[model samples]
Target chain A: MKIQQATLHHLATTESTMDVARNLALQGCPHFTVVVADTQTGGRGRMDRTWHSDPGGLYMTLVLKPDMPAADGLKLTFLASLTLAQTVRRCCDIDAGVKWPNDILVKEKKLAGLLSEMQATGSRIDFVNIGIGINVNNDPARFEPGATSIKAATGATFSREGLLDEFLGALKTGLQNTSLPSVIQQWKTLAVSLGRPVTVVTPRETVTGIAEDVNESGALLVRMSDGDLREICYGDCFHR
Target chain B: MKIQQATLHHLATTESTMDVARNLALQGCPHFTVVVADTQTGGRGRMDRTWHSDPGGLYMTLVLKPDMPAADGLKLTFLASLTLAQTVRRCCDIDAGVKWPNDILVKEKKLAGLLSEMQATGSRIDFVNIGIGINVNNDPARFEPGATSIKAATGATFSREGLLDEFLGALKTGLQNTSLPSVIQQWKTLAVSLGRPVTVVTPRETVTGIAEDVNESGALLVRMSDGDLREICYGDCFHR
Candidate 1:
């Protein structure tokens, strides 16, 4: 779907685009409407955690109306992460891979992240708010020790609009391919977890396994050393 | 856990509480911080649809840092719905029940709803923004035919703070019992769907069945007239 509308906030970066988009959506914004800010004064990741989105970075949220079940909504994040990784490669020629769930990484350093929110009435989904922050033209020193920007990793700086357009375009293409299994295949090719020793952390406990692959529903399949395959639907994975 | 620090935005409504909570969370806000708005100028429901939250209503979002997996985040909605339903019952003698997934209803009319957004590092949830809107003092005639407010149903005027306090108290107790199976029991008791003939609507198709029960992970079990039992993990159900 072509972006129905794109509202760019030049120097008026707030802490969250989800807020802006929520308001916009409530005001009857069409699907694929977008709110992009040059920087976010208060940027956040999943779980109410802080995400560093400095000036010259990409902070935006896309408003989508996918007439799908709420449980299938998570698939949008997977599609988005893949689109972002592919966009990074196309835009900067950097080797970008997905770090399971929704983090985009370049050679073990984080490049971007995706957070999705939805409004559902009963089982029918109404609208989805997808917030994405990419470390674009920001200085590498601005990020934490584990984070890396495209400029830092590839020493290449692209216009924020150029990167956003590429990502949005890729996202549209990805969403058009609604076949979850096919999308999972494309994601596997760009996945950084497969065939790697990893630690999966949940609130209850941590599980160590060899990252195998993801299923059609986007659940991670981890192979234990004892040759047991575990389907982990949710948790954080750390490279061991 | 006690609400360590709470932020109330009376009449300080927004389009999305998730956005407000996300901003607060990024600003190093303490966990359990709550943001409540008397009414939402831009209220949203599931699937990117507009929620009609007029003035004198209860619209709030809580920021939480739960040490739990992202998949388990759905439980927060269940718990919050229960709290809201229970709070309604406490505030008025109205019979409020939980509709499967995330709705609080009085008889067949919806009184409140829950929407959860999360930030995740991997599988573990980093933080969650739980947004809820209750039709407290709004005139029932002003709402959609399917919607009803507390004042409309019980003929009682409630101070927003009184309702918030009750909701927070109930939420605190509900979150303490987070085990999926145990909560399912509480949900069953409060459920208005069980044993009712209902129509389940998905994006792809619709199925009509008798609402049987919910499983350990909160998936609904529907018994078809064909003598087949189907487990519906997600979908919108309407009483037939």
Candidate 2:
């Protein structure tokens, strides 16, 4: 399951890297298998929302078979985000922060969004396919109002391949060294949502509160106006 | 949707009520659509394990479109288990208790099991289909060693349809009255896992500890031998 020994599938265009990676994983593909697509016509984020995966964006899905419970599936998402933020800081010298759940932001503009899907039986996860769409050399602002690319943020074009390689390497190292406890701590350090007045919208209900912190299990702890705490596990969070 | 107003599709036999209910939901079925089967050729529990859904058992799937985030999905399972436990207590005077995740036990013998599946995009859940299999008059002991039926427990044959009707009515009432906060409390009251030494088996890990409590988000809290508390969101638990 080492990244260095993982199989790499490079495609010029695909409907979605998530779909391809899921297929490969179900077909008994090796762990840490990487699927990189130049563009995705049917790329999707959480909730089946379309992701504008243009030619210059880094559209990829990492297939991982971690020796962990399905309840800990979000660990991979947190690790990927931490690595991506560190990779941006080290490579482009640009400060990047993670929004709760899966968005990577640079100065409040989204630089990347991650969507992770897992196939599990009961509480045991068979494989987790993490689809990452990073705005690299592409101009994402044309489609999304709050979006920025590495080139747009830094005013310099960098190799997308180099960025991906750095992230993959960092992710491997993070996976090796970081346990669930440390992953949460490292994620909090790069998080931008804490200590902000936020509105979270789920399908059934909405809650408005000050984002206090994220609990150990990755649920967002929000302090309401009444001083009561609401723990949100998943939703679209808007900073007020 | 009201239970009385729900569209109940009674089948003589099916591969699984979950598959039928999922298809109906995808085909734009209304909320609270129920699919019930006399038996299933391919009944499954958590982790895709087979469930012996023989004739005379109450096999059904309830399709709900709750206006809640996908994070609140487990609340439905909790509600279902609580409602079922109450239904059994009132209908047959058999004391039933819920095990963590989704199991119903009567005096340490499993009487039923629940499996829930949801289709959602982002954090918005379109629908959640809850599959329930309750042994009524059927003898499940032949298929499952640690199984019991209402008949087996009471030595009295009961009508399966009557049991399903009672459960559905109770479930609809529970859904209407129970919020996420109260659901956790109610679930805890009927839970038999808490305050017991248990072993939980996931796909890649095994955790053994004293089951402490379930959090507001429906995660089981286990105190390890080292006195470290671990929150397990999903796993198969065995009382030790």
Candidate 3:
């Protein structure tokens, strides 16, 4: 289905786009509503990690109200990462690959991070806020090691508005292909974490295995050393 | 591992025990920390549904910090439900059975409702609060059509503190048996949703099938009429 028309809310500064966008969503904001901020003081990533939101970076949250099961909500993360990588490749002429879940890596250096939070009743989702922190002109490497920005990678400053517009367009088109099998198939084409030896650390236990593939629900399927396959729904993945 | 000592926080009245217990959990309260309220002005169930927290009911929340992934956090709901059923059987002589996720049913009538909320960093769970509202001496049938209390079921008044104490003791023992297979196995013995035709309404779709069994993570497995088996992770199960 065609996504609703994009509604943009630009803020000079905010605590976090996720909070602002969540408030708007709870107040019955339409789907695809966007909240962008110049900077954030309390930006957060997956697992409640702090996200460095420098002034030159593009920090935004997209409010989505998809008519899908809460379990399928994580598929949007994969869709987003794939679309972002494609967007980066098209707009900046830089080849970007996606790490498992939703991290964009340009030549094995972090370019963008995505965090999705949802509130659901039973299996139905009320709304999901996809918080995105893309290091465009900001020097993320100064604060976080192994981080890279578009300007640092290409040595040319790009317009944040143009990049956001291009990304939104691509995402709007991507939302039309929301089927599980097709989305997972398309995402695997840009995945960098698959077909590699990796260690995934969850709260319960750590599993070291070959990153074989991702399931239709977007869970990482790993082939362990003991001939057992482990499906990691969510974890901190490290490529060994 | 041995469970921690019990810590109680009794309130004459509160907005909700979940909020109070969440604050306590965030403030580093010990595991098995208990927060009880004589009445709740703003009680809530799963999916943000308003919980009818009238007087003469046992309303409480348990703070747990299990060293498990967020994916496996739902297992705690099953564990809680099973323990609650056992508690009712032993204390009130009422044969309580669990309905799918976490509702306690006595003779096909609702006796209690359980809601669990958690916060995690990646797959690591920081804390989980299990909110429980059980009808003790209260006439829940006055408000909820299909709900019953211990008094209504057995024609005898029971002490709220006694029920809470028994449940906590049972839960402490249950915490010792946290293995996935064992917890799911024990939970299955008291499950009323299994081996029956159930209509599950999720946020995405409505699935109707014969409930076969529960997986290790406490997800319900259903055999569809189309000869396909579907694993429902979270949904509202209605017996047909």
| TM-score preference between candidates 1 and 2, better one | 2
lDDT of 2 by residue, B120-192 (tens): 4333456788889999999999987899999999999987767777888878778876466689898889899
Candidate 1 chain A: 10-residue stretch with minimal lDDT? A1-10
- lDDT per residue for candidate 1 within B1-240, as digits (tens), equals 123335554435576666777788768676678887656777777656677878878777888777765556667777777778877887788899999888888979998877776654434455777788888889745658889888889777888777777777777777788676787778788999999998987556677899999887677888998989987767777888
Clashing residue pairs, candidate 2? A46-B122, A47-B121, A47-B122, A121-B47, A122-B47, A204-B67, A204-B68
- The window of 10 residues in a row where model 2 chain A has the poorest summed lDDT is A117-126
Q: Across residues B138-176, which tens digit of lDDT does each residue of candidate 3 receive?
A: 998998888999999999999887888788888888887
Provide the clashing-pair count of each candidate structure.
26, 7, 3
Q: Report the Cα lDDT for residue B26, model 1.
A: 66
lDDT of each: 0.76, 0.83, 0.84
Model 3: number of backbone collisions: 3
Which residue pairs come into collision in candidate 3? A47-B121, A47-B122, A124-B203
lDDT (Cα) of model 2: 0.83
lDDT of 3 by residue, A1-240 (tens): 122347999998999999899799879999889999989999988777899998999999998888765545666767888898899989999988999878999888899999877654443456777889999999999998879999999999988888888898988888888576788898889889899999998767899999999887677999999989998877878889
Interface RMSD after interface superposition, each candidate: 5.2, 4.1, 3.9
Q: Model 2: per-residue lDDT, tens digit, A1-240?
A: 123535889999999998899789879998899999899989988766899999888999999987655455667887888889899989999989999888899999999998777644333446778889999899999998899999999999888888888888888878885455679888999999999999997655799999999887677899999999998877788888
